[model samples]
Target: QTDHYNLLKRSGRAKATTESEDKFLRVNSLRDRWLIEQQLQAQLNTGRSQQVSVSTVKRRLRAAGLTGRVTKKRLVWATKHRQWTTEDWKTVLWTDEIFGSSYRVFHSLQTWFVASTVSSLGL
Candidate 1:
């Protein structure tokens, strides 16, 4: 962004919109920010880039819609059952439901139920 742009040290003349700037650096990980800044500084030395800095690299990453966040993790409940007396069970419906996951990068989501109501599902 303009903020990062102002922080860069200008030194070259190569200013192509589709230059290697977009390809050579991508903030895909935590170390990527520093590494990208180092690489871009090297490019400036060889005149491949006009201005570059850590801030500029981060700005480019942000502009490219790249963001960082802690991954979500949770424990999945497995085979756990509740015990109830016959009189109590008479007022409750007992069943087991089976489900599968949905699309897009490994999610712990339960999609449509593949089986419902143990008896009808023949489980």
Candidate 2:
């Protein structure tokens, strides 16, 4: 008789999330890019006695190719510059590069973004 079993068919525990749940995660993640894993887990665990852990939510998001990042705040234009007339602005030269000493500021707020969006945002 031929052997019916194959070594490639290794068995293990199934995934905690279903296809629909994964879809829901992806949709909501895309809709709100700033939601943290804890927040996402709370949303998914609403009305359930057994709640999913934050790690699971994170793993699921990572599997979906989404990652968390710290969003950088853009430099705000000075109030004095807002009142500048076209003629006044003409005196200043605008270029992509900063010419003098500059300070870099970063915010600690955490947010999530897809891999493609992260690259596009230059984060």
Best by TM-score: 2
Candidate 1: segments with Cα more than 4 A from true spot: 1-19, 27-49, 71-123
Q: What lDDT does the true structure give each of the candidates? A: 0.44, 0.70
**What clash count goes with each model?**
0, 0
Mind sharing the TM-score for model 1? 0.28
lDDT agreement of model 2 with the native: 0.70
Listing every candidate in turn, what is its Cα RMSD in Å to the true structure after a full C-alpha superposition?
A: 16.9, 9.9
lDDT of 1 by residue, 1-123 (tens): 755645577788654434455545442323333233445545544654345665665555555545332122121312122345678668867687676543434433212111234775677
lDDT of 2 by residue, 1-123 (tens): 587865785589777777788778888988976566767888888876777888888888888877764243222344446688989988988777655432322233345666676776788
Q: Candidate 2, which segments miss by more than 4 Å at Cα?
A: 1-10, 70-108, 117-123
Q: Which pairs, if any, clash in model 1?
A: none
**Which predicted model would earn the best lDDT?**
2
What range of 10 consecutive residues in model 2 has the weakest lDDT sum?
A: 101-110
The TM-score values for the models, in the order shown, are: 0.28, 0.53
- Cα shift from native, residue 111, model 1 (Å): 31
